[model samples]
Target: MEQDNRTAYFYLFGDNEDFGMKSCWIRNLTKAPEEIEVKLMEKGIPPMLTKEFCKFPEGQESLNKKNLEIVWMEEGDGAALLENGEILCVIPSWGGDRGFCGYARDCNGQGGFAWELSEDNEIRKRINNAISFIKEWNEEVNPFQSLQPQILDYYEDIFGESEKYYAIDNSDWPPKGLYVYEGTEKIVFATVAVSLRPQPKVEMYYEDASKVNRIELGIILKSGLTNDEINNIASLISGITAIPWDYITFVAEGHTVEFETIASEKFKYAVLTNKLKLLPEMNVPAFGNSHTNFLWIVPVSDKEWKMMKESGSKVILDKLDTIGEEIFSLERQEVV
Candidate 1:
């Protein structure tokens, strides 16, 4: 579909002289590197590498690197060759404040999309991935959706087949949903497709590298909980997985969130962690060049929450190690 340039304001009009650019979000738009360069050159805007994201644009470090390909978008960020053999470019902006990421066809582009030619095949791959991500988002498609079956297979291999699955379709925000694996001793409430789409801008809130990787949330409990309790657990995990998209941010290890209601009265806050202690080691399945991680949601008391906010998830986890690993016990005592 042809897009009206008006979709983008603060654009380079028929002629411009400010020597600056502005951007608007885009949908179903793409231009070849040379085409972008020629368009800019027609206006005498050389596609030179004027702005270098030495650290990569503000949010580049944590974007869906796998999808946006932030890693291969390296320094000495190359230029998009223009009609004059150059194109002005700002490298690696998809991981920026905006959810869209790719080559900003308009120079004044999607929040900040970027791409240029590079001899290095790795950089080429990164640029290609970024372009693909933006296109997918614009067309309202998720390339990761194909990973669902693979995700299910992974869970079954590690956690055993689920007794039941809830929210199996994308009627809600996230296509991924919750799975219940009933065991002789305990029931595992885990998310399967949550990891299919990596959480947005995770590095901004977390120093731990693991948070950036795709992750699935899990909650384990002793068997024999009432059906009402089972439903509550399933609903909670399903919602928690969508928190990143819900809040337009991310939740990582060492992060804590208070809930008005949860599975128990003693716990009002959830302390998320990946450094498991009592639960069995969950080996995640590899997808393409990467692997997903499993993060367990451990319920905590107000006092424990305070300690976690003060020190980190470590303090709370260590205490659990000493006091007890009762994360599954809905009626357990407060650790603090």
Candidate 2:
């Protein structure tokens, strides 16, 4: 994908300036000993200018030993041909504030997405996986509909023997309670113990040398998010993990429902990773509802965490305590 000239400059210098000629000057310096005279003629640079700029600084012998090729790119269009005629790989610059990552195709006219490119191939693959998770989320899983008592009971009947039934879908599963499957996508009625499983992780690299990735799916009951939209999300994200559909549960508290699962504590950290813009603060019913916003945890190694930071997911270093645990307390009240 083409990127902006600013993206390229930012990649190289981590900043932008008109005199940003580091990459180019480095290139000319390397060609000095053998091709300096000839190259200066081609660029119309006086031989004296080439000699002065290409001269090795003290303890910088590596400049003479190296070969560098610099290229120019159109603003916002990352495509460029290096002096050696090689096209650099384009990687997206992730903006965490936007909750997504992709390339910046507009630079001021230098052709590169960034200066140092490493593992972007892997990062791109992971970002694609993240998008897939979002798409799948839109397809399956009724965030609200999964909460009815009837639905929870349905799964309970299948697995609640000492509730020895961990496998709710077993053919021998018996319906010991009310079996209700309301057609409304947002509001379901069932007496089963439903569970919400975490979604798969997406790993993508960004220009910051940091990595970007996400786990599970978060559905903010944004305005206009209908019952159908929530259900579609559930269905799409359902089978991405081994956590069975029967284990996923959504609990209703009023006009909205929150999702969770028996395995939630393990992956609850995902909530901290994604920003959740709750509905506009209401003055009447202060706490919003009588329950906590849902959460899920995802186990990742320190290496994975570091890689995640590299992709632009800001490290919550000083605030690990603030994550996983919810601070809200809603007191149940009857709706008139």
Candidate 3:
């Protein structure tokens, strides 16, 4: 087995940029000096003084007496450098800002992907374990390659010509949702729930159902979306996932169904839970029914839910329509 041959580089910031310093490829922190000297010669400190400065108790006391400060570098912020000097992964400091901590990877120069740390205890523990694994990884072994190659290959294919893919770890913020973006526009917004106890099962649903569906319209109204509009929505979803799969599933009557309808059936739960709200005047008899021209799901936070309740259904529906059009326009421009 060949080793990864990658080195992790750590950095420390001083009181000013002039004193900021970086460490050599750090494989073991315990064996390295705690405080690294920076700009010692440039600061006019003699070579003899530099040698004495590293000489332990007296050196530390002498430096303190001269009002010189020694800054220690830790594993808080670092990057994995490839053998050829290309950066592999960006590592964030532990116990730092929750929003700022996560792993970022470059995908063969096609694009990149980032997974932000969620507040879930299990998820956070997994991230911590990942960091520890990177630190403890011996360069002489190939057992753990840090990241799965299949996952990287999958991202390379999905990103296509796009510049980047950003995914939020949904273990906490949105509960079970995972929202991914291409550039600045949202491409995939899905919520997935998994059951791991007796048997493993996955339930996934899109956040915006209408944008991912195609339907034959029997009646057209001023508020109804055109076929072109519906197609654009489907295109956006396809572009984000880069996977060729049917966004819509039609179940014929008398057919034994093992899976429930994602569009009509499960989406109602999003509404019931205040994650989505439908318009009363849409004239759709029931969600996922044959008569419905389009099925749309809107995500609302607790604060937005309260506001929607007070604003009445008509106002909420209008607001949602406006937002949907804006998002559609953005996606369309990106596609073009």
Specify the highest-TM-score model's number.
1
Top candidate (lDDT): 1
Candidate numbers, best TM-score first, in rank order: 1, 3, 2
Candidate 2: tens digits of C-alpha lDDT, residues 71-132: 32211111222223223333232211132212221211221212222344454444443334
CA shift at 304, candidate 1, in angstroms? Answer: 1.0
| Candidate 1 local lDDT, 25-119, one digit each (tens) | 22212222322344664884433211231122221211121332212221111212112212222223222234333333323322233333234
At residue 290, candidate 2 shows an lDDT of: 20
**lDDT of every predicted structure (CA atoms):** 0.53, 0.26, 0.26
TM-score of 3: 0.23
Clashes by residue pair, model 1? 47-86, 47-87, 47-88, 48-87, 48-88, 82-86
Q: Candidate 3: minimum summed lDDT over ten consecutive residues — where?
A: 194-203
Residue 192 Cα positional deviation in candidate 2, in Å, after optimal superposition: 16
Measured against the true structure, the TM-scores of the candidates, in listed sequence, are 0.61, 0.20, 0.23
User: For candidate 1, what is the TM-score?
Assistant: 0.61
Instruction: State the RMSD for candidate 3.
Output: 19.5
Off by over 4 Å in 2: 1-88, 93-113, 119-331, 334-336
